[model samples]
Target: MAGMPTPHVSPGLYEVFLAVARAGSFTAAARVLGYTQSAVSRQIQALEDETGAALFERLPRGVRLSEAGRVLLPHAEAVRDRLARARAELAALRTLDGGLLRLGAFSSAGAALVPRAQAVFRARHPGVVVTRVEGPSVKHLGLVAAGEEDLAVVSPAADRPAPEGVTLHHLLDEPMLVALDRGHPYAGRRDVRLAELADEEWIVGNERLEDTLFRAAPAAGPRPRTGLMAQDWIAKLGAVAAGLGVTLVPALAASSVRPDVALVTIHPDDVPYRGIFAATPPAPTVAATAFLGLLRETAQELTPATGR
Candidate 1:
């Protein structure tokens, strides 16, 4: 009886087996494969040796498949077809003709920077699929580091360092603006100093003073009164529109704020500009690299003077 077949056979052996079965003769298969008849005979013998079964029966006229060869025909064909499909899909990804792009961005970036870049990327590579998620910059940064996201737009906290395996590409430095009700005393001012608002009630997203927009500024005088806390942008802006309190807005979000609210630039000396960055892995995928370029282009259009 034949010994047990080899457990780990090469895919090339399967290809040779298939060719011989199709041509029905060693000479014909060798001619098709650009090999000599002896080479084809040796290949078939090696395959039979590994399989421990006669894959073909020798006859006076030609060769014919045996029981073992008949049984493996469909499996060999399936492997060939599957490998061909994989090669085509891989080629498509290389050419930007097809693939998935996983993107993440902070809330403010979703307003214009990310969306505009996404639009251009879609136009340029229609066959590529794109998915976007919005959340805090820290969360996006972690996701990028974990390889869950291909690229992310973030405004990382100056105090916190990015997780391992993540690299940040600076996109721009965004100035901060103060949102006040239309009827406020300084609403019409083109710009204002942070000290000027010391007496005014401040609307904040978090209770911790360090987490709010004022974090960029130094602890010069008394902390501003943050009596009201509204986590949602809509609630925060609503409070400002109702003359309840003022909230700081990133320049990227100025256009998206309530029309009734006034936006005045904060003197750079009071609060430094925040850095906007694209987080990526050490070696980004082709789709991710393309999208990064689009992000830079969109940032330029959004902030020509401040964009890096």
Candidate 2:
């Protein structure tokens, strides 16, 4: 039997190899792992030499994992995942008073919900640091899935399913409203029906989200002509206030609106309400769990006041 090659691969080398394989370029892997390209190359070479097998084949544009690398990739990934979980657990063992909370939120929740909950949580845990980021629900979910965020607040539209690998904590059912300039024809209406508004111009934030909810409306009709498309909720709200078109707003969003806009509830028989949920990473730290509990309590308090 051939003697086993001398093992030169350390845990650090395994990590670098995994990053290089995932990124497909030494430069990209270096950037992701905070290492220099030369260092990444050295680690891969060391691993290959120790194993007596070619781990990667250099290409003109980048690199491709060789047969040996393909065989090792899954095991390496499992090792990294276990190490990450161990590190998280170790960090959680530190003093609870000084831990950090990494949170993400969709636009409306960031504007109307997170601030209030943060204020209350900080008052109780003054030593903790709270970091927040705002983005669309899908983006927030992506961050949580990638381990960039501990928890995220999202509003799942009626037809959109909750994302995988996260535990959703239902907080409230926020009704959708039609936002328009105060002087618009539908502004003074107590409720707006989807059928009556089908012919009017609309300002939709995200087409996929709008379609997911609007298609399920009881009064679903021809899609409105999208006069302006906005990626940001604030911009969409501003467009609506400027009479660009009528746009849908959640109850939480309505509460944060400026005085120039009017919010009319969509008929219950029309669009169904959206649900506000707190989504946490598959495995969360103790501090994150505590903050989520506080968030749930705060959401309950804010729900009744919103008449949801």
Q: TM-scores of the models, in the given order?
A: 0.90, 0.63
> Compared with the true structure, what per-residue lDDT tens digits does model 1 show for residues 1-308?
65674678888777788899999999998898898999889988988888778989998977999999998889999998898899999999999999999999988889888898999999999999999999888889889989999999998887876679998899988987888999999988878988888888888886232354556565753376768988788999999999998887888987788799988888878777889999999999999999999998888788953211
Q: Total backbone clashes of model 2?
A: 0
Q: Give one digit per residue, the lDDT tens place, for model 2 in 117-157.
A: 88887887777788998777888877887788888898755
Best by lDDT: 1
CA-lDDT, candidates in order: 0.85, 0.80
Candidate 2 segments exceeding 4 Å error: 1-95, 157-164
The whole-model C-alpha lDDT of candidate 1 against the native structure comes to 0.85
Candidate 1: give the clashing pairs.
none
Q: What's the residue-level lDDT of 70 in candidate 2?
A: 95
